[model samples]
Target: MEDDKHSLGLRVIHWLMAIFIIGMLCSGLYMKSLPLSNEIKFNIYAIHKACGITILGLIIVRIFFRVFTYVPPLPANFSRFVINISKAVHFGLYSLMVLMPLSGYVMSSASGKQIKYFFHIPLLINQNKDLANTANELHSMLAYFIVLFIILHMLGALKHTFIGKQNIFKRMI
Candidate 1:
């Protein structure tokens, strides 16, 4: 892989994850607004759940990949402020990516809902109503932070790519 961009494996995972996360976000929001007990709603909810579990697995792999790989350096003239924000945004994004799915799993399990991967493989985790309720609330609240961090991450990339003429996105492409 070129020093200007991410490795092919990372790029593939990054784009694949971007698409899946967007899909998961939209589906989750739609499902939350739908009336319960409807068939379509149920199906969409199931899909969302499956995707969440899949993302959890993928994120685990991604974390390992990230830990073992080297990222391209920032531009020589980049300010400390920019570099600090970059670190924070990336840290926030990774934290949310890992926590979001775990929280959802806890929420589902606590509610005594079986987690199925693609509606096939069963995920057997502990169940507790109180725990589920707590995780459910936390998951809902944590989503705001995730959205905020994602927007910040994108904005930083755009700033570097367009304004700074750094083409930082090339590293991720």
Candidate 2:
């Protein structure tokens, strides 16, 4: 039987999303590491916010396409445990992708900071300091998990490509 594959557009968007996510993660970590003032931190955060919002938009489109498109199934020989784990990881990734930016936006808005998307329109959410702090904490903690998952994801893809001799990497490329 012929191998099922992702559509070209889906593949392109997938890889682009991956790049944006990595960029956001790196910039976020760097911004956190800096000993800058709140204003400076906010400026850095604006960039992060822009990247994150872009990612959120891309993810929405990806999710829409996923629902409508005919995505290829995983290998039949794949174990149930592996399949379950994959589902859990995918769920986590999607949930975090949606929540992280929303949390950041809430944090900014609550602190009386404007959430600017690049040079585009600003996001103005109602202020709530208590909620903002909670979101901020969740965003920070989830970031560590994102980093770990990304590392594992990369390792898994490499294993599939090098050892399994599968075209798993090509699916996203």
RMSD of each: 1.8, 2.4
Candidate 2 lDDT, 1-173, residue by residue in tens? 32467776678887898888888888888888888766777677878877877888888988888888878887777679867876777777777778877777777777667657756545476677887788789889888888877776777778767887775677665
lDDT of 1 by residue, 1-173 (tens): 48766567777788888898888878878888888877899788778788888888888878877877766778888899889989989888888888988888878877777766746544456667888889988888777888898899899999888998988888887
Error of 2 at 138 (Å): 1.0
Clashing pairs in 1: 5-171, 6-171
| TM-scores for every predicted model | 0.92, 0.86
